[model samples]
Target: MSIGASITVVAVGAILSFATHVHSSGFSVIAMGGVLMVVGIVALCLQIAALHRQRQMTAAEVQPPERTVVVRPPSEY
Candidate 1:
């Protein structure tokens, strides 16, 4: 979801850039660019959070058992 959102944000940015070049944006190119950049950063952060959560779950499921044995020298015994 986050990845898709980020992609969409970039696509929108590209469209805006091209549209501005073809037409004009005396109104607010800076505003559009700023919004797109903020949205993209948010999406990227979300994706990163999702990945970290997944890793945490995987680690929890794969933990090794604690029971184990060790051998000592007969002479010491």
Candidate 2:
């Protein structure tokens, strides 16, 4: 997902893990939240790294201009 989505997931996960208290016979809310948070953080990190790599690749792809030397005829003495 995008960065914003990842952040939202992390925020929601934090709220579920810390703010709410609900006990059920099924899966634990806190554990699920923790998992979501971890996945979101990993996605964010990978997205950032990919962006960084793209920038580096583009920079490397650019070619600098070539310089030329000019020759002039010798002036009569």
Candidate 3:
């Protein structure tokens, strides 16, 4: 997921975990929230790592021009 989406997931998860008090008969909202938070964090980290790798690759692809030298013969008297 993108950074914004990841952050949104984390925010939603926090809201669910800490702000809400609803209890379901067959599911745990808090647990789900925690899971979402973890997923969000992991996704964010992965995205950051991927971006860093891409930047490194791009930098490596660029190179400066090679220098060249030339010699001329001496003029005859």
Candidate 4:
């Protein structure tokens, strides 16, 4: 996932975990939120690592300009 999406997921998870009080017999909202937060954090880390690797590859691909030699003809007397 993208960084923005990851962050949004984390934010939503935090809100669900802390901002509301709802009890359900089927599933736990807090647990779901916590899982979302963990997933978001892992995705964010992976995205960052991928970006960093891409940057390094890009930097490595760049090469300096090639040098050229110029020759002069002998001057006529």
Q: Which candidate is the best by TM-score?
A: 4
Q: Write model 3 residue lDDT over 1-77, tens digit each, in one string.
A: 89999999999999889999999999999998999899999999999999999999988888666888688899899
Error in Å for residue 9 of model 2 = 1.1
- State the lDDT of candidate 4 residue by residue for 1-77, as single tens digits: 89999999999899989987999999999988999899999999999999999999988889667898799999999
- TM-scores of the candidates are 0.56, 0.79, 0.81, 0.82
Q: Return the number of clashes found in candidate 4.
A: 0
User: In candidate 2, which residue pairs clash?
Assistant: none
TM match of model 3 to true structure: 0.81
lDDT of 4: 0.92
Q: Give the per-residue lDDT of model 2 (tens digit) for 2-55.
A: 899889999999998999899988889999899989989999998889889999
Arranged by TM-score, best first: 4, 3, 2, 1
lDDT of 1 by residue, 4-61 (tens): 7897887787667556654355766646866786778788788989999999999998
**Ranked candidates (lDDT, high to low):** 4, 3, 2, 1
Q: lDDT score, residue 50, model 4?
A: 99
For model 4, name the residue pairs that clash.
none
Task: Assess each prediction's global lDDT (C-alpha) against the native.
Answer: 0.77, 0.91, 0.91, 0.92
**Candidate 1: worst 10 consecutive residues by lDDT?**
16-25
